[model samples]
Target: MTAAPTPPSPPPRRDAGRPRGATIVAAVLAAVRAELAETGFEGLSVERVARRAEVNKTSVYRRWPTREALVAAAMEGLLEEFGASPDTGSLRGDLHALAAPIAELAARPDGVALLRAALATTAPGDVRGAARQRVGPPVASASSIVDRARARGEWRDGADPQQAVFTLVGAIVHRTLLEHADPTGEWLDGLVDLVHRGVSADPPP
Candidate 1:
């Protein structure tokens, strides 16, 4: 029987030097993170990030479209700094687990500097809108720990998860970014206790 017409072979994937596209993205992100660590967000620029990353500004702008977009992307690199909040089943434990990373970062000069820079600058281009897209997942995960605690009858029904998240997190941001002081675990522990007492359904015996 005549062989069925062979289906045309799929076109071979073209290299088009596109393999480096992902690498470039990674490099640029790394550069931004490095700059934030060293100089803070205030010192960041597309050119600076590109220079640190060993890439050209054109490539960075082309990939990100705007400075804000790039900043948002850079902030995303901090994902590793954020961790899953502990479900220790105690409000204090849960809050401490959530706040510890933030406190640690706030205490670090690099982290504090970057955050200060981020807060000081006007968001470039579509960056403000893109920020929630980038930081939201981490924020949501952290907040979920609180939600779980509430479900367990640990926290009061009036507790606002988003507000709580921001309140606790904002304290770190304030000390690190604005106050320009070292944040300590002892301080963080106290803050956690304060927040827990405010939200706990039952007062500590």
Candidate 2:
């Protein structure tokens, strides 16, 4: 009888003992943020990110084919880490809470650099679209605060939610980017109070 054919070898487990996919993604993202913090967007590179993350460049390219996409993803992650919006049962308190973190971030040199670089490097449409999504949660929180204030008859009806939210954020951005000034706690409190007064004064529909 002919000798039995040798049994086929089992397929190699290429990913055996490797970190999970989600873990790898998180590592890459963390590396992206670290790179941005340390070097800003102009200095960011896929190879550097891969080295920092201890991940393969191919993996990053596979997920984010372009630098713009990677930057957008990194910014989105950063925004999410800002945590949930505050609901202190009053509009003024909520605005203060919202402005506090922004002011804190603006106070950091690295944070200011990151924001400026992101704004300067990203294409206009890409940055605006991605920023809108990234900022959506906080905007929603602001809207909720407005709704609560309206319910309590503290805020005017027909107040523009978008304008109200942006008023607070715009002040922080102006201080951080245009003036290159660190926002004092006193300044933040005054900003919230001013926006509250403006919104409160809107004529009712």
Candidate 3:
């Protein structure tokens, strides 16, 4: 009998040699956030994100196939610095530190657009939460800042950590996105002072 003919080999995967690790994850997530800010949720496309990330579309699809999943993954890495507010040693200091960067971000056009994407009522749930994480994290998901403050007996009567955080972030977003004003350092200080007083167990100085 004649020997069976050899079978043809399957084609290699498009990302066969691509490095799949933190580097790829970081690039992909970064691309998704930039995409969300510029093009927004409605305009976001896997192809564009892949191109910006310099990775194969297959790679992104393999990790985050759905819009919700992609946005959630993007959020997982966003504003991570804000997640852990270091021991500023006082509630006022902590609040100031936390508010400063958010204010700074709001001052930029990209930041304004980015905030618009997050605060959009029509955006998917996860995308909305990502921008809110600037303050949200300090309350639940991210840090010990609130816990530390509570332990120090710093919070005033009926002042909830969640609400306190929301208030601080909300002011920044309103000023930068709605008012279309720069979140100047001077302004941030004033905002922090106001929020600090509202939440502090002691009265404002």
Candidate 4:
């Protein structure tokens, strides 16, 4: 009969109807960082992160699959927040510009704690890989500075670009974590000057 016509089916669920993955990912990562900052990695858990993020546990698992992976992702976000590379047109200026912000980040207790937690839990290779990613932009910036210096005959062509980057960063990290020293303006300036002198192609007139 005409009265027996079937009712129309409901519309299919679409990804467009759900929260954007980027938003969810940001929230989750933020939560992970917060957890790390508050409780350190030893106290971290999927449930705690899920609660903090207000997302399902399954969602966190789907994305990160493990606590270490989640922490790595959060640490990666922290590195990204360090901002872009500096290009002040000279090697010294670039080093000065880059050193200030990195020192500032190292000064933050939460930032240092997060770094420690990641180092404690994650594999050394993985940590190094993440570090490479974190430092990639700054290294490239330093390389550009090196290139400019070479063009101007301020630096030798055979200088190692990576060594230049590591020198400043490694020293900052050492003083921050080991010596318990502030990476103050005076310290940073001296560090830059020292590195510049060591790497310069010719003695300053």
* Strongest candidate by lDDT: 3
Clashing pairs in 2: none
* TM per candidate: 0.66, 0.66, 0.64, 0.65
Candidate 4: Cα lDDT at 81: 58
Candidate 2 local Cα displacement, residue 41, angstroms: 3.8
TM-score preference between candidates 3 and 4, better one: 4
Per-residue lDDT of model 2, residues 1-205, tens digit only: 9999999996533223566588777877777767765666677789998877777788889889998787677666546656676678877787788778767876775455446544665445675466456656667777677777888777876678789888887888788777867785788888888888887845458
> Per-residue lDDT tens digits of candidate 4, residues 26-118?
888888777765666677788988877777788889889987688778777555655555567776786788677777877775456555564
RMSD of 3: 9.0
lDDT score at residue 49, model 1, on the 0-100 scale: 79
lDDT of all predictions: 0.67, 0.72, 0.73, 0.71
Query: Lowest lDDT 10-mer window, candidate 2?
Result: 11-20
By how many angstroms RMSD does model 2 differ from the true structure?
A: 9.8
Tens-digit lDDT track of model 1 for 52-141? 677767788888887667767766655365556667777777777777776776676445434644454555534444433433444676
Ordering by lDDT = 3, 2, 4, 1
Q: Whole-model lDDT for model 3 versus the true structure?
A: 0.73
The better-scoring model by lDDT among 1 and 2 is 2
Local error of candidate 3 at residue 118 (angstroms): 4.1
Worst 10 residues of 4 by lDDT: 11-20
